[model samples]
Target: MDEIFHVAQTRLYCRGIYNEWNPMITTPPGLYFLAVLFGFCGYERYLNSLILPFCFAGLCRLRRFILISTKGKLKKEIDQFRDVRLSALAICFLPVLLNNSFLYYTDLLSLTAFIWGISFNSSLISSIFLALAVLTRQTNIVWPALNCLAISLNLLKQFLFNQISFKQLFFKTFKFIYQFLLVFAFMCFLVWNNGSIVLGDKTAHKPAIHLPQLFYFVGFTAASSMPLFISYFFQNYKKIFNRFSLISMLFISLFAFLSVNCCTLAHPYLLADNRHFTFYLWQRFFQRHWIAKYLAIPFYTFSAIFMFKMTSEIPNKLKAFYLVFTSLCLIPAFLLEFRYFIIPFALWRLSLDYQSRKAQFFEILINLMVSSFVLYLFLNRPFKWPSDPERWQRFMW
Candidate 1:
């Protein structure tokens, strides 16, 4: 039975290849060539095809030089060595590991690259991974763009605040731009060589210009602006309500939630094809479509409460007012379609706390876990409760 299933799977993949048209290629040559080398071994080929290379790249980029020493037993030493940064890295890797290790999906490759890009502070690497992500699946385009944009904006803000000089900022910005361009060009070249203009033959889809997408952007901007907004508010007001920093953090949290929800609403689709909007609409309206929509409320609620707590200056009444106003403005699209808003809302909230190492670490860990788990459950079938004894035992053991 297993042999028959294997043969059938091979034939299916072969058929997919034979019917391939312009830009309909399965994956980049880097992945394809690897796939071909291991093709004779069936499933092993799929595993080796992307996983090996991804693992290699990931290990190559691991910053072993930052290690700290401790006098303790191996386990104790290792535990202590896993600082917040390492913890953050582990959190980032967990989702990709789960996806690739269990499901054999290539999506994790790009995600890994994205994580590496951020971890190593390598724009070029990030761009390359993002391009691969788009090639693997187009819906991933927003992430690379948003990530780059956020970094750029943060640097710009630092320069404006005299945290960094204009000259230094300019050079850094230029380097990032150059790296992005180079990676993008290489990806395009690879696509062209693979007989595909874009990543896959799949038709590209886009979201309809709707209130939801708009509100998502608004939420994103508000969240991103939280620090500045809070700072501005506090400077103007003599006394802090709850705390100036916390107020700023709230905006960011709201933004992150809204952003994720926005993306969820749109359904991540490639840019080349024209059918993305259809996918977005279908997912948005389908009540039981994905776990992301269902989990959004709790995620956003947590973020909202956290933000409220972070602010020290705003009186409960004012906080209530702020929350109400912000929610009202942001809720329209999110309430109508929740997934499209959650991520951005969370990211926005996160940005406010980025200045604090502890806060930033927590933000990254929570967001990564939440996003990854939701995606994993949604993609898998025969949904079972996590508390099921067998599943829980397997996970724990």
Candidate 2:
């Protein structure tokens, strides 16, 4: 769906018309620049095909980072290099990303940049990749911002725990974390010139206080990670009630209720673009009836609880940073696009240590199954718009 605009923009870039801009395109021209550099210049399909290796390489880096960071916490069987390779291969098949990889979309490269930004051992290189990520998609600025916040907070934590002296903390804090500054300066320029985060299609992409976007994000992720959720439940079902107090449940339910009732949004594109799967989802489920949103509160609450449970093994400070980073990424978008969930989902999935190979296998299998189904529908189930019968539309993530 978005490839048409992206292809045209890149064709202009291929023609050396770098000054041209597409008002319908919201992201920066970094993706098109990469296309030109890769010699896929005017050919969208070739560009998509060429990006797969980079995506795979980024996923491997991500797996290594996760393994090293959580060394002793993982099962011996699951920590092998073979398992690492397998997991990276499986993650490459993630439904949303795998579907987009065959199309001329910026999401794959944007995700690759984000992955390498967090996973690289050298901070300088990581920062540069993060800067490129922000250039590709402005929303990606949140990751570098989160990194800076996390570094500062970690230093404070070390000082509080007497793991580092005040002088050490001071020196660390003063160290050059130029990515945040660079991104901040670039954002200021954008705001000064364009007057908004969105460079074009401003009306459609304007920021909103869509609180329920968090719920949609959580719910979608929960549904995607169903295997993990199911396995976690079965393993802990006996103690689940004890761990979850009535007051906590009540509070979560109340928060979910308020988020849905007060801030549920329906973007115009979400309603009008039947070519996207979200349109059918919204029509058939979320907006089916007045009580539908209310009915969804329990699912949201459950999803949020399980997500917290899954990440409970991470350091408390890092967990807090994770939540804040995820909130910053998801809570502002007025649309319910699954594409926005890709990076956050990748981070969450890689952070986890799957207790059983069975669960891991099921997760991979589920992703493959869904990707195949989506691809089939997208290719074979074309439909025509009533107003434009000559044009064919297909459902996609």
Candidate 3:
């Protein structure tokens, strides 16, 4: 953050700020411009710290919007209470969000723009926020457009089902294409102004077809958000396996086999260095051990199932959109990074439109338990996380 603020303070050229003379940056210049807006104060980090307040404010607003968006799906009484309940459970319990906000990273702002962009009703207004979302983080381009993609997909479905005339479909498509073109124009300008997409050492972000990194990301995300609908998984496991023809198990086996034989795709400097909370414990006992990696694949496989099955009860349009969007979000990544899962996680938490009342109730209960447990753990225990490897050992990779 200080580096970002310093870059903004010293120079205005986006690419130059990240060139060999300065710190490496993989994102667009929106964050630097934002830091400029905050103004140079007592210290660069101090100015950065002020963003946390705005971050939480945006989060509260997002929660309000999410609640309002889903209000119509529930009964009048439940509508009044459900959003607040779900909001508390999902937001308060999420350690990643809390940590990200606490660290005053640019993610909160990007996330704010993303939720606002998707939830806003007006097309022009939504486009503006969506544009802002992409500027905040390059990866956000797809997130803000998810609703549009879903709508577009739904339109195609309508056409396929003979509910909409060919002319109507074409007209809507043409209209949307122009709107998207405007957004794309702005993005191109920003990227050109920033000089490059991967602003840091280009090799750092070179795309790879590694599946293990993606597998880990999927598994971790599923585990983190499992309390949302885990009861359904437990109650219908047998049916799910039978109906799905052991497809879930097959995916599990595939990833497990890959984990042991294939290389682990993880970042050395990602989130407090390479060894984070969960991976730290895994590494302590099973460092470089293929068995541990293989064993962890099943857990990830369950998570993948949970995530894929989240919107099963919702409209197939939404399900298809999510499937495509989630894959697009992960496929290009060279290594595992939890931030990549943020958008899908947000969408997953908001997928309550077509859920049963009982499912909603249990989900709320699970959230409460999880939130309470997280709070309890934080309040009552001493956190003993491992420090970074001494002087960045080569083996750390």
Best by TM-score: 2
Q: Name the lDDT value of residue 342 in candidate 1.
A: 33
Better of 1 and 3 by TM-score: 3
Give the C-alpha miss distance for residue 90 in model 1, angstroms. Answer: 5.2
lDDT of 2 at 277: 88
Residue-by-residue lDDT tens digits, candidate 2, 1-397: 8789989998998898988888999888888888888788656677767667877888877776677676755455555544565667666888998998889887888888888877775667887888878878888888777677678788989999999999998787666457657666776867795667787678888788888888888888888878888999999776556645456677889988888888889999999999888999999987889998899888888788777777665777777777788888888888889999888787777776554667768878999999999999999999999999999999899
Global lDDT of model 2: 0.80
The TM-scores, one per candidate, come to 0.41, 0.91, 0.69
Q: Model 1: which ten-residue window has the lowest total lDDT?
A: 63-72
**Across residues 1-397, which tens digit of lDDT does each residue of candidate 1 receive?**
0123323334444445534333434344333333444563355335535564554345323322122211122234333343323433433333323433344444445444443544455566666655654554433444554445666888989998999998999887776784556446655665765633344443442223233343333433334334434544445444434465456556755655565555544333322222222344345543445554434443343334444444443345534543443443343332233223332332233223212334334444654665466454445523335455453111100
Off by more than 4 A, model 2: 73-77, 81-83, 150-174, 243-246
How many clashes does each candidate structure show, in the order listed?
A: 52, 0, 0
Q: Which residue pairs show backbone clashes in model 2?
A: none
Order by TM-score, highest first: 2, 3, 1
Q: Global lDDT for candidate 1?
A: 0.42
